[model samples]
Target: MDIELYHDSKYGNGARVAEEFKRLAETKGSNVNIHHVREAGSKNLPRADLYVFGSPTHFGKATRGIMRFVKKLELPPGTKYAVFGTFSGAAPDKKTGKMPSEEELEKRRRTIPMIDEALRSKEMAKVAEMRFFVKPENLKGPLEDGWQKIVEEFVVAILGK
Candidate 1:
């Protein structure tokens, strides 16, 4: 299997995930090519069995660069694709120290959903989706614990190994 992984990682969290995904997929006998979105333009994306896109959540949505890249993709209809995102989990209120409810966080976390919409609009088939949490206190993060395991599981799920 051949996989192309692209990421727009402002603070490196998404980049880290993409790197790990590539490493694991390669070990499983898949050919993986990884690129930053800026380096891999939409007009000339390499052909692959699957394309994986990753981005860090910005204001609850994918960064403008990533969104533009997804919008410009011209892959064949029904192309296999997957998405992943790095998000800062809800932080507690400074004064009250009260954390937002899961429901509220859901409303605020639309990074994956935004990418999914763009891919769906292009008629791409989604194989899987995932979100890795950044620590709430720091947006530019060391991702939450066990993120590597999560990425490994994601690679297995997508590669079917």
Candidate 2:
């Protein structure tokens, strides 16, 4: 299967994750291509059997830039897709804490639901399956604990033999 990975990383970890995903996918036997969200603008992507979208979670949602980029991630009907994100927070609190992280106030005010909904129908109408991960922004992650299995499983299920 041909796979395309699109990502927007502020600290460039998003790209690193995209590269790791491509490497892993390649070992699994697929021709993979990764485009930095910025570079994605100049080139038209080839038709891919699978499409994975990722971004450094900024303010509880994908970056506005990434979200805009996702509008471009739109694929033909039935294209398979998945998603992942990175964020820094203790978790939501009952009272709005001072500074309210972007994920807290939701900078774009439409991060989670927008990406979730987009992956549901916009990016790929027939998502074989989907996945989400949260990592501390300052700590840097795409951590490889039990979480690795979650992503691997998502890929395996989507590419059922």
Candidate 3:
């Protein structure tokens, strides 16, 4: 299958994950084209069997670049689509020493769904979705270790391998 994947990465975490996806998909016998969202422009993308988009979460949403790209995306009806996101999970309360509540978690998890919604708005069919949380190491992330395992799982799930 032909896969067209686009990503918006801040500090390179999202781009690294997208590259990993491309590598795994190619190993599974798929032709993949990966691009940064900014460079992709708002034109009609090349024909592909599957379309995948990913981005790092900034304030519980896909980065501005991704949102802008998705906003202008034009895709054929019923095109297979998937979404992924890298989030730096909820922060702890310094004073109370407590974790974020369920509601807060829900809010923080909205990035992928938001992207999925945008794709669906373009009449794309949703095939899969995933989220990978990165550890905040002064924003120089190594992707919280073992992130490749989840990437592999997502690739299998999305491609039916």
lDDT per residue (tens digit) for residues 1-161 in model 1: 99999889988888889888988898999998888988778987888999999988877788898999999999999999989988986788889999888888877788898999998898999999888998887889989999999998899779888
Clashes of 2: 4
- Please tell me which predicted candidate would have the highest TM-score against the true structure: 1
> Candidate 3 regions off by >4 Å?
136-140
Highest lDDT among the candidates is held by which one? Answer: 1
What clash pairs does model 2 have? 59-102, 59-103, 60-103, 61-111
Cα TM-score of candidate 3: 0.93
Candidate rank order under lDDT: 1, 3, 2
**Whole-model lDDT per candidate:** 0.89, 0.62, 0.85
Winner on TM-score (1 vs 2): 1
Error of 3 at 2 (Å): 0.8
Show the lowest summed lDDT stretch of 10 residues, model 3: 133-142
Residue 127 of model 2, lDDT score = 51
Q: Residue-pair clashes per candidate, as listed?
A: 0, 4, 0
The predicted structure with the larger lDDT, 1 or 3, is 1
lDDT of 3 by residue, 1-161 (tens): 89999999878988888889999999999988999987898687898998889988777778889989988987777989889988875567668979889898778667888887787788889998888878753445768889999999989989899
